[model samples]
Target: MFCCYESGFGKVNRFVALFARQSVVNEPPLGASDFKAAPLLQTHLLKHGQGGSGSAGSNFFRALALFGAGASGLLSCATIAYASDEAEHGLECPSYPWPHKGILSSYDHASIRRGHQVYQQVCASCHSMSLISYRDLVGVAYTEEETKAMAAEIEVVDGPNDEGEMFTRPGKLSDRFPQPYANEQAARFANGGAYPPDLSLITKARHDGQNYVFALLTGYRDPPAGVSVISASQALLCFVL
Candidate 1:
């Protein structure tokens, strides 16, 4: 079985952090070496000024302003070039303030219910939730009775009978959600070489999580004049409806 978790902090790191919290400042008296650079650095700084209380100072300010304008123009050009190159890396979506955003906030149950319904009616035909079971939905998206009823609706493949035959039975809370295809080869054939990925932990693997998924699902577009690209709808034409 595979499992995943984030290691936010370790014992050693925690100990160091605690020690840092209790730390007090201590200073050693400055030695001769500390003063060594002070006079020289001051002299260097003094040399940079064109003049003080003179026409030379006004000229220096004017030159400085001109240099600033030129530098700003170059920086803007570089910024444009960098943005053009970064454009090929792909677009970034603005962070949406979700309903459950803060540490104390909880997910919207209604939205969860609606998403599950959409997944069941549409995405389930192509995708699988292999890691999730009906029991997992209880109290999250549905009541225990509702989850059991949903589980029962799908016929599950079960163990061998007394005659040593594999049999189909009503699904139970313990049964994992079924795969659309029995195996990868069949899945590839059905989806034109693109095996639909399991939806379990799908968004978690993406950089922007569910927000990324929402953008991807809604970001379909026609390719530019001569460009061509295949999409899920094009590949799954047989099951698009």
Candidate 2:
């Protein structure tokens, strides 16, 4: 019985040794770096999908890199757009009459006042200076009495309408400059083929505001020695509009 047990133990040892050798031969060898690189290769190849060649896997990686670069570019543009929106609109305005020279003058309270006077005397018949209120002129160094006096000159429209009747009221500090023409249609009709534009925000809206104004004011000519007369405003309207 001892001899039979010993023989059975030896057979067990032989079987175990043969199984270990077979396992070693069947299993593939892998290094640490190979293990790490395997997931990367699988991911790249999967993006290319089944039946994709090695070259296709490389292309997949290239496409992924381009997508990442494009995403980065979009992020950069968004940052610039955010910065631009945060910047002051007035400071970036093309028409804020500065760093340029013409008859309209630089941006200043005094220049605005002078321009207002010039506008009232020379340009107001056709154009409306509607963006500013009389109250805003207080910063122009006008005394209260002077401001009142100026206000008293213009007639304002007021009162409730049963008859839709018009009544004259003294201009107040809060009133914006009134329109000369009844509306855009009337303005266009009066100016031949062009419409008289509002001057209120002109200095803030136009890039060539100063030169354009200066040129318009001084551009009147006799056409030529024998040519027919054309209105200066007409000529200026052609260039500006």
Candidate 3:
């Protein structure tokens, strides 16, 4: 027997179970067979709930739901449980049809450039992308010349000079992105003892990170009353002209 819970009301797998329990329910199926089956189906379903041996109708539909859920990852008991858990710990994310999605889709270069500009202006104040370098931006978001110019805007620490002294020079394409703070201790001190993590590690470190980040940027809202107690998703990106 498949155990499940229905949230309030919906016309789905839950509706099937709910319908089975009903003495009479309106269903618009185009056939005399549906009418013929309802009598047997109702009898079997009602008996199944009462600890009697279930009939083929109950087993067949439940099995169908299980397989469909496994394949499509929806309409199963597990989906509800997972959603409830996420609702407890985090805000629900609204879906958006992002341009750069799916097998045939490619990155939106102009939008990416704008987003990168925002990251540099605002998010760079707290987050560091230690794993990424300026060269990675070349041919992706910005041209080689533009990236080189941006790299040169920052001063990078170079090897010990002729006099055995470390010196700073204009940053090169090879230099890792500059950090917001000099060290972990400084980072903590500046941010109320909370060390801002390296944004470069987000994709590798977090499950479903791309969606998570997108959610974090857009998931500020009041959850359904009494349904969830949510924690915040921090969004540091700021879009400015």
Candidate 4:
């Protein structure tokens, strides 16, 4: 016998029992006539109201639903969880199809440049990369003069403190990025208790690195029947661009 609870407005109780008397050995050929045996006995108990008994069909269906629920619950409990996939149903090329291998390599310099442009226009409002010197922008193909000009635009304070008092500094690579909040605690408080993760090395640290980055940027979708997709506002990469 097994006992379980079914939750609705509150809770309902249920029980299922299975018993066998004796085992019978069967000879070969195993014809349908040779397999004649007694009918299996099955009972279902469901408590609905203060003083009420359920019909046979209702009890049988209830028992079936309970069994299905139990089996699904067991299977769900035993499964190992993994991150949801973002790949779509269609394929770009199918002749040499491989679910994992068939994915396109999406390293595009133009896209990275565009991403930088988007970052400067929007993300720079709340995030700053003090570790990334303007000089480092050269790696993204910016000219030396442009880098210097960009560096000069953001001033960094410097002076000797004879009296021993802290002063405001503009901005510098030596300084950590200027967070939207004073600290992680403050940031969490401001963003609905969700602390924004630092974006440094996000592209590199993610699994599959650049490919994952590209796919995630394009993954937002709508809800469906079994496990429908949802168009999400959440993403590490700036997908809007």
Which segments of model 2 are wrong by more than 4 Å? 1-108, 161-166, 218-241
Task: State the lDDT of candidate 2 residue by residue for 1-241, as single tens digits.
Answer: 3355345433433333332343346433233444243344445444554332445644554555465456556666887887776462223322333643557754466666787788888888998877877787786746667777898888998875688787889998888877888888888889885887787778456545565556556654444545554434233322422
Task: List candidate 4 stretches off by more than 4 Å.
Answer: 1-110, 125-130, 155-160, 168-177, 224-241
Better of 1 and 2 by TM-score: 1
User: What lDDT would candidate 2 get against the real structure?
Assistant: 0.60
Instruction: Give the top-scoring candidate (lDDT).
Output: 3
| Full ranking by lDDT | 3, 1, 2, 4
lDDT string, candidate 1, 1-241, tens digits: 0011112222223322332232323234223453342333333323443233334433443554465456556666887888786665365654678878789999999899999999989999989999998899999999999999999998987779999999999999999998888899999999878888788998897656777777667655554566544543322111121
- State which candidate has the highest TM-score: 1
Local distance difference test values of all predictions, in order: 0.65, 0.60, 0.66, 0.46
> How much does candidate 2 score in TM-score?
0.50
> Candidate 4, 24: how far from true, in Å?
43
Clash count, one per candidate? 0, 0, 0, 2
Score every model by TM-score.
Answer: 0.57, 0.50, 0.54, 0.42
Better of 2 and 4 by TM-score: 2
